[model samples]
Target: MAQPKYRTHVGMVDILPGEVEKWQAVERIIHEEAKKFNFEEIRTPILEQTELIARGIGQLTDIVSKEMFAFERGDDQYVLRPECTAPVVRAFVGHHLEQRGGTQNLYYIGPMFRAEKPQKGRQRQFHQFGAEILGSDDPIADVECMAFMISVYDRVGISNMSLKINSVGDPESREAYKQALIDYFTPHKDELSEVSQNRLEKNPLRILDSKEEEDQPFIEDAPVIGDFLNEESSQHYAKVKQYLNELGISYEEDPHLVRGLDYYTRTAFELISPDLGAQDALAGGGRYDLLVEEVGGQPTPAVGFAAGIERLLLACKEMDIELSEPKSVDLYIVTIGDKARSWAIQQLPEFRKKGFSATMDYAGRSIKSQMKDADRENARYTIIVGENELNEGKFTFRDMEASEENQLPLDEIYGRLKKKL
Candidate 1:
């Protein structure tokens, strides 16, 4: 037989049992925080119509241009979703959810696909937890999103983070800035990396985000977006900063933070930590005000942010945050005789139904071996059922943690454990 051609590769991962608890605890915190902030959960298809992403997310962006996993199905082509906002906007329009003229706060936690060279805390397929607030352009809304993100990090015990923000400006100002960027890079065109050189012609703003060592010096000297911000964009950015100040949220204005998405219009921001090597962004998001209108919804204004779960988990490990302890077994049934074994088996379901994490010696080992196994599993209570005890309808209950033992009738065992547990 031929071996399978595609085995698990470097960029993929399988979450094992020992690590699953941390993942679950993180997810629980996300949900709890989202609920506290009044954001409703929304699920979008993992596979989206290709054009939805190509148009909604921007064809010039790396995610749409190079990272997407595209395939054909019947008459239509589809791509695995690379981000959450685009599909959520599609759903908002298709469902006419805002016809009532109200607002929607949506949150999603799921896997996002991107075909990038894997590194520390990054994978080909990674999961992101995100929240989007649509239908409001209030600068306070932007601050709220930022605050919520910080709160989530705090809840997860991640500290030593710096918040960096920038205003990408509305389409009008962005185009003007894009022209300036082109003119600035035009003279240094030959010095730019091949990837950046290509970006210069398509989306010059993306050149600022280039990671190539060769592009750094040139990108640093390029025109700052803050200098070119028009009146409306300037005021919007100022108000956002003012709100952050009011909330006592410390932030640094980074003119270079053009988030890697075409949909972003104004107010792009990232939460960074020095602990993460090259890719230090623990969470990132920004305003995509024109996205709804760009994608055929009524001029809806939106802002949102996303944090990588794996990266956040790494941060927890680096910061030494403890995850919730594993569940403890309440009881282990140890049987010494065939009749006692039969009786123990009969009593197992009732013990479980009474809300106890119970186990029994399925190996039918000696009582000594069973006791050792029970200790290894950290069973809180051990019930010994030998021939004499079974004949008397009584059992020996030993407390592993307290190191105490008691005698109990089979009929009273459930009630006694209920009180003790």
Candidate 2:
């Protein structure tokens, strides 16, 4: 026997029938919550210029340096975007969305590609639903962004998640903290991992974001960004906490919580859930006032967060949250006898045109097997067509849940379904 030569990629997933229902439920809630926050949806292409990612996400960051799936085609280099914020900003700038006038609250739902060691929930091709607020530097904008994120999970019914927040300060204090980090880690340089050793002079904050076990010791004892927050940033950070408090949103201040991206400034946060084993972060985002300028736009303030839909489904499963399924079959038609089959097939489109989700067996299955299909599909009603019904000038319609059957003319069958179902 020749084995199948093709298979799904290692870190990719197929959202199949039974499982896709959960995705539908989660996405429904995401859309509903985003609507309440007044965030309109924006979609950017999955493929973006490789240089856009490298320049916007930062060359020193792990996403651009190691994980990007880049290729050169003709005169241009392209990458399957590892994240959406940069591209959203690029569209905002390139298309001049600012002409629309107010601070735009944009949300997106799509797949983001990144090559990483595949794990449960965190896949190479993962779906994310995130919202970004452009043109507002107000600390309230940051609080609202976090609140919007928290509200999405709340509506999703995924409990036991904690919000952890911090401030990276602005550029000046960030620079001060980098120097302080260099001073502190220079002595223990030999104990650091080669990656940390390489990142020390270029961007030491990324070293703090490292996952290498060997780098943890120095990372733990390193100077915290809180200690380096300049007065203006200190006020900004205080305002974010105060707003969160005013709105009754609880959070824990985490000094070491610098986001993984380089453009982040001022506020940073993560939503952590114990449902994910080692990598507990369910979502993370922060303020990136410099990202618009970094992506070729006029300097604009933005705040957003991205959460993995796969991880969210896992978390829902762990919490025992019930996910509602999508619409089931409204009508299943079972035809017997060649003449009745021919007649039923002709009527199928008519039933559908009357706003019923109707389907039938074209494979000439037995009545018993056709009825089984109706039951498996959770059909609300099943209509039986046969020589007896054709001769009687009526059809046999069954209320599947109540086990009641009635003989009615074609128009009356539609009336009964419309009235009762």
Candidate 3:
């Protein structure tokens, strides 16, 4: 094989053939399960206003500050969306989806762009699918969102995943907590990593989720968010756990489990898969009750979760869960001689119009080679178009799987194929 003149950019992948089957398999499960939970699929443009992402995800957040693929042209600024939940909410508020609705349950599946260097399961251009239940503040709504998050993994045969849950508390509680974190870490600021140092004053809660080795010592002793939760936030957080327990969804409480994003509040959860090795997180999501109101809508409450499609499929592969087999063609047309080739090309569409997946030799290869092609493609049946069969007004149809051949007219072949199918 010759190398192509072009290649995919860094931090990207070509999900060709065998691997794409797994993606399709996973995607189908996602659609079916999402619909089962009353999630309406919504597609937003991959390009969004830069301000929307900065404002929605928070300016101090890593995604907005470091990982965003954004640009400014003239007076206008545009960005490739780094996450879906924010864009979904933007569309909801922009399109007035609330007017005709009650608790709009929307879901999205598409690619997101970030400027970060790619790793095993992380990509600069990665795909994510998530569900957002807007207009509900009930902790049971939080429980349902979390359940929906793990439903795909449950059905897809992935195993050995740990559910880690935490509460960042609401705004009022979070403010006092931020001050506590600032005061606690301020003295040790010089000893912390640059990232952690920057986060100390702007948003101290982010330091808790830092991955820096040096920062870990300081983060280890920092105050937990649960300690600062007010009466209302504490009640809401307790209800979320109660519901999870009732559903038999076992979870471990983590003090520093604040998700990477700044929008999350009250409830946060991560599904960890040991199969992923170093980058072991399967998915992370939490409550963002202030998101809708932040985006110029009324003070509507919402909860959502986002999972990396690449990461999920990676986990499936690591666990040796066979998602799908190689796709096989229904019919392969093996043509010999000029006249027979013409006849095959003419009738191929008719076969397809009637819903048969048919393919033919455009190379005009030898009959021997054409037959080999049919075998290679794993075709279920091979129809030989040749002088003898063409003159007899019948075709040599061979059942590739059975290694049996028979002389059959077109209608008979169609009938037999339909019956077998």
Candidate 4:
């Protein structure tokens, strides 16, 4: 038989044991910071009807058009959600949550999917920690959401980020601005990429978000959306900025900062870390006044943001933020003879039941080798259960750090370690 070929997986990743501690630390900070703002956790399925994303997230945008992992089941096509907001809106409306609501503050942390080329801080399967406030149009709500994102970064010790803000206006104002973009980009259509050209005809506003360097000057000189904002939208945006100013939150207005989603209107902002090379955004979101209604709900105005966990972690590394290393084993039980090995194994369940993390060497190594292994585990203490010690109903407790060893009765071991932990 020809030699069997083994191929490694592509476009997918498995987070291994070493990376898990970083993920846990990130989740801990996210949960702690979100709770401080009274944001309740909300979870939506990974699979959503394809149209839900197509309609709400914009079929023209990269997420819905190119990146969505869509598959068909029976008659309906479903997508592994590339973003959180659309599915959340579907859950909010389908459950009729607004009927009971003054306003709902919701947060979510989980995996999201996109079929894109994986790069540093950009993966096909990645995680996001996001918070959303539904059924409120108050600009303070916008500021609060921005502040919450900033607080998470600060808590994680990520620093020196720039906040970029923009206003795309409400329906009426945007309709006028769209025409201006179409007129400007229409003349320069041949000079633009095929994707930009298509966007120019369909949703011209998306042209502002194009990263093509050749497209920059034309995009920059294009009419500002703020100038075309209607009175209500202009005031809404102004009030959001006023709240940011009063709270001493600094931000720069970027006319091109329209977030890449169909739902966003009025305020849009992104917290970016420049140290992250090309994919610099750590977190970004904006006001979505039409999102609830877009997903077949009654007219509801909502605003929220999603922060990329991987990007945030990258920012932490770039900033040299010292994340705590994973908590060490409370105690490691080292055994010599076969009898002591069996005894140590039985004692593990008891130690863990009492809320202490305990482990024993299963390899049946020599007593000296086991002690070395305990040291490698960064164990607070090691219990040596040699034949002699086991016969005496006692074990030698060696403090891994202090190089101190003392004998203690097996009955008193759990109690003694509990205090040390």
Candidate 5:
């Protein structure tokens, strides 16, 4: 019988070198944009207490009830993070990050796990890069967060994208709207999808964002949250829109843009690209003022967004945007004979120490074969060391691109390559 070949787990992918380069390019833009906005990077664990996510993301949401990868270990129940915001908040409160009492601007880039069925641009094990600003409820914070997110997408050269904004309103107003959604959805109970019907009783706002074909007609006619916003929430939403307008940023108002998570309160937004069909969102987030207190921190207001790295890359591919390729080695050293091979081994570190990417043959291949490898790697220069050259204290340097060769003394080789590089 033949043995089974190993394969990558379903919904999980191995990011090989060529594809990883594109991911790195996107991450570079994220880091650069985050730095420009004065947001520091923060890394949190992938695993957290199950209760944290259940409470933070809400028991009623699909992420907490249906998607989370959770299990019990001994006496403790833990879960792989389905999203970043809840874990970020857990870290913030657990570490007492708010002890200083000022706004905390933090960013993260890492893998997030969920158990959802995979589709184009959606996966169970995926990556997210996002920012969270804790301790500020001011409308300017919301505006700046959106601006920073848009700037990242702009820097990445992704086009044909649109920003949709909405305000779910404060807790009081949100509750009133929830009741309104219940009233509207209850009439169409038998027509609602099984998933949406469950959400109708648990969290009716989620039904508005549902992808169910059967529920769209009813959701389209449902009452808009904007109509029910309280005075303060309404003014806050207006100021956010005004700031976006003054910044020359264009956006469309989306009354049904309630985010997937239950913690979000006011200022919900999503950036969608036409390239991704069906699952069109490239990134989304909103204000979550009550989450901090729910997770055992003091009442702190915050807003932020997270973009899927894979989805962003997908958009780039659809638009034919070229990402940066990794640079090749500066030199490939080819050696002949025992003395030359030993010398090449010793000199390899010297070349690298001077900031040159240098590689040499370790498989004891022929000089001709090593030269072929050098060409395949696109090495700029190839150094040939032989018995004669070792005895003469000189080396032969060939410029691969120009097809030029020079015989330089051992000490002069470094200077010559440094100048060329």
Candidate 6:
């Protein structure tokens, strides 16, 4: 017989038991925080029309230009969603979620696909939990979204993160800033990285997000969007900062922090953890007032943020914060004979029905081996029943943790275990 191939694809990972517990811990916090903020859950498909991302994320952006897993399907082109915001917007438009006319607070937790080189805290298939607030352009909405993001990090025990924020302004202001960037970077075009050189002509704002070492020196001096913010955008940014200060959240204003998305306007922010090395951004979002309109819906104002679950766990690990372990079964039953095995099967379901996690050895192993397996499962108690014990109508009840043993009637065992558990 041939051995079956058993390997995960490149840039993807299988989350085994131990690590999955940590992921659950983070997800619980995400759900809990979302509820507290009045954000309902919305799940969108993992695949979306290729044009949705192209139009939403912008054609010149690296995610659309290079990293999306796009392919032709029949008469249409589809791509595994590289991000969720665009798909969520597509859903909002398709479902007419905004026709009723009030703000919709929605959140989602799922895997996003991006065809990028795998690295620590990054992969082709990565998970993100994000929230979107649609309908209101108020600065308080931006503050609320940011506060919720910070609260999630706090609840997850990731405290040493820095929040860097900036305002890219409205479209008119952004265009003026873009021209300034082109004018400034054009003089040093010969020295800029190849990617930045292309970005300069295509979408100069992307040059600010470039990680190219050669581009850094020139990028730092290129242009500051804050300098060109119009009256409305400037006041909106100021109010967001004011509210964040009132909420006592410390943040740094970064002139070059334009998020790597075309839809963002007015406010942009990123939470960075020093522990994540080169991939330091733990989460990021901003106001995208034009996204809905861009995706064929009414012009709606919205704000959102997405944090990488892998990055959050990495931050927790660096801080030496341990997540609570999943609870194990209350008891493991060891049956030493056929009669005892039948008796064990009868009692197992009763224990489970009574809300106690219960299990019995089905492999018919030796008592010692069964006990070892029980220990590995971290069972709080172990019940050993043998032919003699079953005949005597009593069983050996052992407390795994305390290493104490007691002989109890078979009928009385369930009640006693229930109380102890």
TM-score (all chains, Cα) for each model: 0.93, 0.95, 0.96, 0.96, 0.97, 0.97
Model 4, which residues run further than 4 Å from truth?
A: 1-9
Q: How would you encode candidate 5's per-residue C-alpha lDDT over 135-185 as one tens digit per residue?
A: 999999998899999999899888799999999988888889999889888
Model 1 C-alpha lDDT per residue in residues 289-329, reported as the tens digit of each score: 88888778888899999989988988888888887676568
Mind giving the per-residue lDDT tens digits that candidate 2 earns over 279-343?
78888899999989988889899888888888888898888887886558989999999998898
Q: What are the lDDT figures for the candidates, one per model?
A: 0.88, 0.89, 0.89, 0.86, 0.90, 0.90
lDDT of 3 by residue, 231-292 (tens): 89889989999999999999999999988777788999988998998688888898998888
How accurate locally is residue 310 in candidate 2, as Cα lDDT from 0 to 100? Answer: 84
What lDDT does candidate 1 reach at residue 179?
98
Local lDDT at 271 for model 4: 94
Where is model 6 poorest over a 10-residue stretch in terms of lDDT? 410-419
lDDT of 4: 0.86
Model 6 scores a TM of 0.97
Q: Which candidate, 1 or 3, would have the higher TM-score against the true structure?
A: 3
Residue 8, model 4, lDDT: 42
Off by over 4 Å in 3: 1-5
In candidate 6, stretches whose alpha carbon ends up further than 4 angstroms from where it belongs are 1-4, 99-101
Candidate achieving the largest lDDT: 6
Scored against the true structure, residue 169 in model 4 reaches a CA lDDT of 92
Better of 1 and 6 by lDDT: 6
